[model samples]
Target: MTPPPGWYPDPQAPHLERWWDGAVWTEHLRAPEVPGPPQPAGGVSGRAKAVALTSAAVVLVAAIVTGVAVLGEDDDGGGPATGALPTSVPSTDLPTPTPTRTTSEPPADPDAVPDVVVDELNGITLPLPDGWTPPKNVPEDDVVMTTDDGTYECPAGVGLCRHGLVLTRTVTENDEKSPETLAEQDIPDAADAAYDRDTLDRRLYGGIESHRTVKSGPVAVAGRAGYFVRWRVKTADGPGGYVQSLAFPSSVGSESPVIVRFVFDAGPDGPPLADMDRITKGIRSIGDADTGGGVGSSIGPTG
Candidate 1:
């Protein structure tokens, strides 16, 4: 960026701010007006200008793509402690808002939801993976955590993510299937929810555990209390992926022994969770085994 026709060069800024000496635009200092951008070079037609602008836009788009790709492999996406891995879920204080029957976070069609699986605890269907070989019954004091995409503290196929951590919890719930009327216990919070990586089920990726809450319209889950959710957001960085979960609480607080969920970090399905267009096209909520819900679902809200 050369300065056009300066007056004189300032003694103090000898090598720097030079000034136009005089007539022939000398390097002398004076009260000269700031020079504007140079005019376009002479061209035969205006096509060159248009082409230049288009090229600039293309370059910007390309740069974004490259940045994302590079960051995607950066493990933690350069976030806090989560740092490219999932963390542990500790017993802690969670949102204590009253649960409502809202469809703000309704589970989607089972077919559309990937990574989410269902299992049977007693007779009621529990949400688990086909391959998750648990100890059969989860303990009451057992710690819980959930994630979006990250290494699973548990086995890969289970609710645990094999990629990154998220902002949800996973509890075996002492093998007790949730009754229609839950006694309603207090949940944990961030400080209590925080757990070490070792305590978590390390999947392919490493990170922490998470928990979330919602409040909205209700959806029936196999004759039980249920709600339709707008979206499910999880982090590849374990629990406490607090950003999006605040959107709803009731739709997410289910006591099922196992709950299946899909994790999303990037793409159109991230941040506040996948949009309705993508979620409806993917998530599926199964009913009883007698119904299409199968061993995978306890009949949560359907799309």
Candidate 2:
């Protein structure tokens, strides 16, 4: 018959004890308790008394041995060490170690955001979203950037289907007129013409219906002072929408400022104005250039 589950002296080892985990002898083992010093034998008359004291001593030692074995029990629920431990030696107390915090930084997410487009012209730079791309050729004075793969559009085959977002920059010499005055005068004219490129290429044609100013105020772009104007335009070909334009003087005192316009015709779902503002703020002037602000140019009323 198999022995019951318990700690027992190992038959294979001379002095070490092993745990018989009910079915098998486990690897857990401990050295047997060290034998104590021999006691001196008493005289013949005192022999009887000596024997009685010896019996009591054995009982006391047995109790101590059992306690030492139980104390060796593993906290992990594993079997206790098999051998008897010396009762005379004290157990060492150890401090529990605290866990450490990791300081390594996490890697950047590759697919978290879309790519960006940077447009540089006339020494000024503008950062646009990924969809915006440069056309093969636009008007010499104006740098036009458009989004070709945009999901937003008007019905196909219509008279004025929106071709995604359109950003146009018109660099003109300072004509002494304030930015607000120039925008107020130019926007109405462009809207009155219906933004017809063939009829008025340089001036924006707002269509037959007309374009009205929605809001206008002072603003700053890339740390340069500027004026911002919002417009509402309607056309016969498609639903009417809003246009945002920002014009700022490139240099102080008699220097012409650049006019940047953002036009998108969305019927109900309009462009996110906050995001547009962020894009506008990204505008930076790399350096000054001779933009050749000539008379009757697109920058002023003459064009």
Candidate 3:
């Protein structure tokens, strides 16, 4: 194409520095005097700026698309820029604790059952009242387990007597109300009943009473609970009277303990509550024994 008139040439241009005129080259193509904005970094041409801007927009769009894909996969609205709402978390479910009970089994004949702690249930025997038959088996209920206690009885007319005691087991929840609290309810009531029968009835009314006793703290039964009591009422027969009970808390129920107790009118050979305690101290938990609670002897029964 033919150059037009008045076109100028630029000496600064690396190539094609000349401007076109209607007929031929002219030296009028001086570089423009006006200055441009600062050159791009690294002195790149202005066109490179446009290319960089387009590249940035492309990257931003790619990020948005990637985030959208991630949000679709989770469907949990975890991705930012998805404009999605979050859902509430569901509450967790937990397992509940179960309760256990124990029962008493008859002691096997030494000939039939080996004479060991397992057979004994780590049990210590007590004297049964004359002619009174010990129940075949202790009832199984909330108890952990029951042991054979021969029998228990107090003579009519009140002076001397024999008693049998059986120990049993029961499990309790860690958070449940303690056995002491439960015992406080029954213990005072039992003692009060005995007191009314002995003091008000016998001492005041019947004219055959002797004395009374004060409140005592809870006692321990080997590895069990213990409670105590006192008898002030003496018979017209002789100078003899005593009181006792066990009130220890159960290891199983950190909240409380099973209340164990024994009471009697002093006899010629007075009931063996004292000796019973001596033997009880010898008890050991079955868990510690050779048997896994099968055949071992101890004062404390393992829970």
lDDT-wise, the better of 1 and 3 is 3
Root-mean-square deviation (CA) per prediction: 26.3, 15.3, 26.8
- Tens digit of lDDT per residue, candidate 2, span 1-303? 344677555444323456667765566766444343455665334665576567656744664565455455543424434343332332223367999998887898864433334344434666656545554344323435555443333332323333435454544644644767766555654344334343334323234366666677766654556667777777655565566667666543334666676666545554544545655656555542223233212232111
lDDT of 2: 0.52
Scored against the true structure, residue 259 in model 2 reaches a CA lDDT of: 68
Which lDDT tens digits does candidate 3 get at residues 1-303? 332354222222311123434544444433222223566567767686687666656654554455346445432432221222224312223367898898899886664422223213323332333322333443312122122334233334543223333333332434434444544544443443332344324431123354555444443444444443433445444333343333344333232444344333355544444543443343344443321122112323221
Question: Cα miss at 86, model 3 (Å)?
Answer: 99
**How would you encode candidate 1's per-residue C-alpha lDDT over 115-205 as one tens digit per residue?**
4333322123333232222222232122122333323343223343222122323434454344211112212222122221333433322
Stretches of candidate 2 off by over 4 Å are 1-18, 21-119, 127-153, 156-166, 172-177, 188-208, 251-255, 287-303
Whichever of 1 and 2 has more lDDT, that candidate is 2
Backbone collision tally, model 2: 7
- The count of backbone overlaps in candidate 3 is 28
Estimate the TM-score of every prediction: 0.25, 0.46, 0.32
lDDT of 2 at 17: 57
- Indicate which candidate wins on lDDT: 2
TM-score of 3: 0.32
Best by TM-score: 2
